[model samples]
Target: MTRLVVLSLCIGMVSAASVMSAASAAGPAPSGTAGMLFNHEHLNNGSPGWNETGVRLNYTLAPRHAFELAVARTERFDLRDRQLSALYVAPLSRELTGSLEANASSTHRVLARNAFGTTLQYEFAPAWLVHGGVKTTRYDTVRVNQALLMLEHYFSNFSWAVAWRPAHAFGTNANSAEVRASYYYGDKNTIGVILAGGKEAANIGNAVTLTDLRSAAVVGRHWLNREWALNYGIGSTRQGDFYVRNGMTLGVQYAF
Candidate 1:
């Protein structure tokens, strides 16, 4: 569910990229709506180490729809079990928009959980975006379904977004929820922070467990040419005192 909602926002960012291009253009700038990037990172904060290099493509299908495809393989993560996703952006009105998406995987490793999901979005106001949806687990015994609601505002080159949701971790009726938000700043450089707390049920034992996570990220981008660019971000995740991981990514992209 979080994956889909974020993709919707990414779609919006792609559309806004075009709009920003228009706003910056003296005349008609080349109307190219697709941007592709190749990203790499050697990052490890607390969990299994991850060194990844992958490519991602983001583009528009129409004035109201967008699509994205990404494939990345870590040292331990399977290359065959990659990531691919799509989104349908709907505009309820000029300033209001909505979207739907599917985030799926080709294989479910031990590390894989909630590998597939569906999402929906509603933009009730210009300063706020609302969303709700659900997702389920892809493997055995464990059945986790999640629903979320989010609100966000965009101002100039920066924006803030926050959301809360109920997550049911199958095998029991107990449900838990979490709230998280991130803020970005600058024309291209950005920083973000997230705070989340929730609970979940164990699939095998049916025991309930509290889930709390904190995250912070720093990103930088540099455009070398009209069709070439670079992007990098570093972030850390704290999942209680038991599990923690730090991740970093860098990519060079060429768009046609």
Candidate 2:
């Protein structure tokens, strides 16, 4: 029973890591030229866990350039994983934009990863867009490569986005697809939902097997004033038969 519990915990961590890895690789930025964000998450399923308070800051220096920095920690059982990342965005043309990002993570007492990626987005119409990017990460002696593609559409008060990502790491392959939709109201308030899932290989000891993953969430944001806002969400995830994870996120943001 103890061994089974440990195995389940590792699988859950892998499931979470896969999603975070893809989402952080190449993503669209939200409106508002600059802001500071504070976020927290509490999860229980495979093993009770919670993410340490996360912080992010974003600023647009000009019409053509922007910068962002973020930090977060995840605690599972008695171990902790910490991550830090930085990103820069610049316009390549009136309809094209490019972004560069760098990230590092440490798990427990050992360095876990160092990664970098570049992404390019093209606006085909006022409301339609496409983007693609490639990322590379080094995990000790192993290297991982990832490719990403996304399509997005925006209306006056609603937006939708979809993405496909495939990656190779540690002698295994993983792929994921994600969809998100949001509707805006009262100029600053919004409600949204997301659905995402994927498959990856998990190697335990000498056995290699495939694991299926699924996750969904509903989120909302409300503004108290012109500068202060609240964000909240609840979600659930399944990692094959290893365990089911359910979680909630709470956040606050200040716009400048």
Candidate 3:
């Protein structure tokens, strides 16, 4: 009965990535455009685990150029932290785009002290894109470096992507891979499934370590009207020798 309840809730909620990435993937809003997003998440592992609340603001300066600011509060394992993040996206050419992001935390007990990343996407062929990025994160005990390469293709209203991510931390290397499939129904409306597995480097309570990780999630966004939309994700994660987490996220976005 407990497992059934969790499954039901998962089916109704959204993924964390879906809520955050949906806006960026849809491209820049109109010039002088502004938007806001409110997000909440909960995770459990037999006991009360993590709860998070976040808000993000976005503005477009011109066509193909935009920036976003976000703030989040997280509570887990009796520790609380606040995080701030900023992102900028712009077009490099007709077939190329780039993004840069940076983030910092008020406390490093359960989060990274700071992190920075950049990514570039190029349309190499019709309906096909290639992406590459690198990131570095500073934690209380260790620094983690990571990189990713991905290929994506779109057909009709469906899209598929596969990505490889590699990381090094604590004098160890970890490799992870993921596959995603998405369906687009209307303007900025999408649903997707993501599956990922392998080893990952994570910061856990001031310690950075490598762990075997496996996860799956279903995520989506649905536009309620012209200016309002709903985002949701439901997922589970298994970390070897650590813990299993079942989580759900919900978010709302409004544009003006």
Candidate maximizing TM-score? 3
Candidate 3 TM-score, C-alpha based: 0.84
On lDDT, the stronger of 1 and 3 is: 3
CA lDDT, every model vs. true structure: 0.43, 0.60, 0.66
lDDT of 3 by residue, 26-78 (tens): 44443332333333334444444777777777776654456778788877667
What's model 2's lDDT at 216? 80
- Flag regions of model 1 displaced more than 4 Å: 1-48, 75-81, 92-96, 111-114, 172-191, 197-211
Question: Residue-wise lDDT of candidate 1 within 111-227, one digit each (tens)?
Answer: 233345444555465544555556554444556666656565555545555555566664444333333333333223333434444454321112224345454555555557666
Instruction: State the local distance difference test value for candidate 2.
Output: 0.60
Instruction: Report clash pairs, candidate 1.
Output: 39-251, 40-250, 45-246, 46-245
How do the candidates rank by TM-score, highest first? Answer: 3, 2, 1
lDDT (Cα, 0-100) at 54 in candidate 1:
51
Give the residue spans of candidate 3 off by over 4 A: 1-47
* Off by more than 4 A, model 2: 1-46, 107-112, 140-142, 200-210
Worst 10 residues of 1 by lDDT: 3-12
Clashing pairs in 2: none
